[model samples]
Target: MSPRKSVADTRRTRERIIDRSVAIASVDGLEGLTIGRLATDLGMSKAGVLGHFGTKEALQLAALDGASAIFMRLVWEPAADAAPGLTRLTAVLEAWNRYLETERGAFPGGCLFTTAAVEFDARTGAVRDAVARLYRFWRRRLVAELRIAVARGELPATADPEQLAYELIGAYLALNQAIQLERDSAAPDRTRRAVARLLAAG
Candidate 1:
C-alpha cells in the first residue's frame, strides 16, 4: 500500500484497539487491560499492539478517552438541543438512564467510571488522576445545568446547585448498584421517580 493508505489503516487499527480496550476495561478494570490479552483477543501480535500504544498507561488513557467520547455521544449529545435549564437537565438525565439500560454493548460490566472509581479510589497515578478528572467534568456539567435552572427560576433561588448535583450523582450510583448487584429490574423506574421528586422539590 501507499504510505498514505498505510497511515490511514494504522489509524483505523489504533481506533479499533482503543474501542476493544474500552469494552474490556468496562467489564474488567483498567488494570485488566494487558497487551498480551488484547493481542490475543484481536488476533494481533503482542508487538503489534504494543507498537500502537507504547505502554500500558498509554493504552489505558486511550481507552478512557474513547469511553468518554462514547459516553458524551450516548448521554449528552441527545440532550444538547434542549433549552438550557431544567428541560435540558431532565433530558440529559433521561438520556443517561436510557443509555445505561440500553447501551450494554459499550459497557458490558456497567458504568466504566463506576468500575474504575472502585478500582482506583485508593491508588494514585495518571490513571487515577484521569478518572478523577472525568468525574469532575461530569459533575461540573450537572452543576452548570443546575445553575441555569436556578437562574431561570425553574428551581428555587435558595437551591444549592452543588447539593442537587450530589443527589443526582448518588441516584445514578444507586441505579448501577441496583442493576449490577441486586439484579433489580425496577431500579431504573425507581431512579426516574427519585429524580422527578428531586426536581419537583427544587
Candidate 2:
C-alpha cells in the first residue's frame, strides 16, 4: 500500500502488458493489436490496458520497443564478446541465424521486424518510422563490423560495406520466407550457404 510499492507495481504491470503485446504483435502484426484482446488475454480490463498506453498508437509503439529489446538481447548480445572484424561479424551473423532458427518461442511467426516491415512498408507515421529506425539500427550494426573487417584486411579493400550488408539482409529475408511461407527444411542450410558465399567473396 506504500507509494513506492504502488509505483513499482504499476511499472511491472505495464511491462507485463508490453511483453504480451510484443508476442501477439510478432504473429499478428502491430496493427492487429487490440487493447480489448490484450486485456482478455491478460485478465485485465480494457480500461486498464488503455490507461497504461493512452492510445492504440502508443501501445503499438511500446510493443515495437519491446520487440526490439528482445531482438538485441537474443541476436546481438550473444555475439557481443567476440573480437571485432571477421570474427565478430561471423559470430553476429551466426548468432542471427541461430536466433531466427531457434527463437520461435518468442516469435512464433518468424522475425517481428520482417512482419512489421511488410505491414508498414507502405504506411506513414510514427509506427512506420519506428520500424524503419530499427532496420537502420540493425543494418548499421552489421555494416560497422564489415568496415572493421575491411580495415583488418579480412575483406578486400574494394569491398562495399553497404552492399555486403544488403546481401546479408537478403539472406535472412529469404530464410524467413523459406521457413515461414514455404516450410522448407533446407532453408537454414541454404541461408548458411548464402552467408558463406557472401563472406567468402569479400
Candidate 3:
C-alpha cells in the first residue's frame, strides 16, 4: 500500500479503538477499560491496541475526547444557533433533556462526562483533571447564558447566574441518575419543572 493509504488505515484503526473504548468506558466506568477487553471487542491484538496509544491512560483520555465530541454533536451543537440568552439556554436544556434518552446509539450508558465525573472525582492526575475541565467549560457556558438572560430582564434582575448554573447542572445530573437507576418515565418532565422553578427564582 502507498504511504498515504497506510496513514488512512492507521487513522481508521485509531478511531475504531477510541469508539469502542468510549462505549465500554461509558457503561463499565473508565477504570474498567482494559487493553485485553478492547482487543477482544475490536478483534484487535492487545499489542495493536497498545501501539496506537502508548498507555492505557492515553487510551482513556482519547475515549474521553471522543465522547466529548459526541456530546457536542448531540446536545450543544443542535441548540448552538438559537438566539443567545434565555432562548439559547432553554434550547440547550431541552436538547439535554432528550439527549440521555434518545442518543442510545452514540452513548448506550448515558452521559460519558457524568460517568467520568463519578469515576474520577476523588482521584488525582490527568483523567481527573480532564473530567473537571470539561465540567468547568460547560458550567461557564451555562453561566454566561444565564447572565445574558438576567441582563435582558428575561430573568429577574436579582437572579444569580452562577447559582442558577449550578442548580441546572445538578438537576440534569439527577435526571441522568433517575433514568439510569429507576427508568423513571417522568424524570424529564420533572427536570423541566425544576428548570422553570429555578429560573423564576429571584
Candidate 4:
C-alpha cells in the first residue's frame, strides 16, 4: 500500500488540484476537463486526482464551489462594506468589474456559474439545481440591497427592487459573456456605466 500523506499535505495537494481544475475548466468548459489533463498539469498521477474528487462531475462541482467562494470574496464582500444604499449598490457593480479585471486567472474563461448555467440549463439534476439556486441567491441579494437603497432615500420610493435587480444582473451577465469571448477589459467599465444610469433613473 502507498504511504499516507499528512492531513495538511493532503489538503494542500487537493487545493492545488482544484485550483488547476478551475483554471482549465474556465477556458475549456467543464465538459472538456479530464483527470488525465489535471494530473499531467499538476505532475501527479491520475489516481491522485481521482482520489481527491472520485469523478469528473464531483470535480466540476468542487470547482464551482471554489469559484463561488472566490466571487464572494472579491466581488460581494468588498461591495458589502459600503453604506447600504445607492452607494452600496454602485460599489457592488464596481467591485464586480474590479474582480473581473484584476482576478484574470481566478477563473480561466470567466464566471464558473455563468459557464455552467449555459451548459446545464436544459439538463435536469443536482448540478442544474445547484446552478439555479445560486442564480436565485444572487438575484435576491441584489434585490434586497436595492430595497435598502429605496428605504434609505437613495432611490425613489416607487422604485421596483426586483426589476432593477433583474436588469442589473442581466446586463452584467451579458457583459461578462462578451468580455470572456472577446477578451475586452472595457466591457466591465461599460457595465458599470449602465448600472450607474439605471441607479440614477431609480
Tell me, by lDDT, which candidate is best.
1
- For model 2, the stretches where C-alpha displacement exceeds 4 angstroms are none
- Over 33-137, each residue of candidate 1 has an lDDT whose tens digit, in order, gives 999999999999999999998999999999999999999999999999999989999999999898777778988888898999999999999999999999999
lDDT of 3: 0.91
Tens digit per residue, CA lDDT, model 3, 1-202? 9999999999999999999888888889888899999999999999999999999899889999999898888788999999899999999999999997677776788888999999899999999999999999999999999999989889999889998899999999999999988999999999999998898784
Candidate 1: worst 10 consecutive residues by lDDT? Answer: 98-107
**Sorted on TM-score, highest at the top, how do the candidates line up?**
1, 2, 3, 4
Q: Over all chains combined, what TM-score does candidate 4 have?
A: 0.91
Candidate 3 is scored at a TM of: 0.97
Each model's lDDT comes to 0.93, 0.91, 0.91, 0.83
Locate the minimum summed-lDDT window of 10 residues in model 4. 1-10
The estimated TM-scores of all candidates read 0.98, 0.97, 0.97, 0.91
- Per-residue lDDT tens digits of candidate 4, residues 19-55? 8877887778777789999989999999989999898
Best by TM-score: 1
lDDT of 2 by residue, 13-80 (tens): 99999988888888899988999999999999999999998999999999899989988898889889
